[model samples]
Target: MSSHRRVWYPYVSPFDPCPPIKAKAYSTPPSLFLGYQPPNLEQFTPMEALKIGTLWKVFYDPWYSPYEVSTEEDQS
Candidate 1:
């Protein structure tokens, strides 16, 4: 005797209507690890001077002040 039993399902005609399908909503998590923040290059030399202290004295240039602007007379 066979232990397995056969099952039968009803067959639908070609004229039968199709069943409706349900849609699902999905969301993605924020990428905190992959996000990047740019560095402030303008503050680089000042920050370095603070950290390095007196050692920055050797690299200082008295003639090259970034705050001073050259006028037309100065350029001439």
Candidate 2:
């Protein structure tokens, strides 16, 4: 079954993480997971990371986000 997170999804079928908020879905195309190079950690400034971390902390619920899980938005 298809899911609708937003009323108007900009990208057609095969898009993932549409920008500031990247919510992964099962419908995501296989190509996305095929050897995708993760963003470079070296370029991230401390402040940038801190901001993202704080946003992620609030975005996810503590119960769902176990202390061990990495901060990837598992929308699916």
Candidate 3:
């Protein structure tokens, strides 16, 4: 005789009796983390996206911009 009393529900086949699952909501907008490759775009457009890798794209004025540093490294 088992010491534990177990309440067993009748076996229901096919349909799942588990609790309903809720979809996750995004609290914040997605950001491009370091070394992040957009996985979703891969399924749709792979070849086109590959032209630009982890590097950020600069359309214009990057060379003459104030942020540009001539030195190899800038601590400032």
Candidates' TM-scores? 0.17, 0.19, 0.16
Q: What lDDT tens digits, residue by residue, belong to model 2 across residues 1-76?
A: 2221223234444555444323432233323333553453234455865755532222322222223443334543
Candidate 2 similarity to native, TM-score: 0.19
Candidate 3 C-alpha lDDT tens digits along 1-76: 1111123345445567885433322222123222364443323234533653323232111122224543323442
lDDT for 20 in candidate 3 is: 41
> Candidate 1 clashing pairs?
none
* Higher-TM-score candidate of 2 and 3: 2
Best by TM-score: 2
Give the candidate order by descending lDDT. 1, 2, 3
How well does candidate 1 score on lDDT at residue 49? 74
- lDDT for 55 in candidate 2 is 29
What is the alpha-carbon lDDT of model 2 when measured against the actual structure? 0.36
Local distance difference test, each candidate? 0.36, 0.36, 0.32
The TM-score obtained by model 1 is 0.17
Candidate topping lDDT: 1
Q: Which ten residues in a row have the lowest lDDT in candidate 1?
A: 25-34
- When summed lDDT is taken over every stretch of 10 residues in candidate 2, the lowest stretch is 56-65
Candidate 3: regions farther than 4 A off: 1-15, 25-53, 57-76
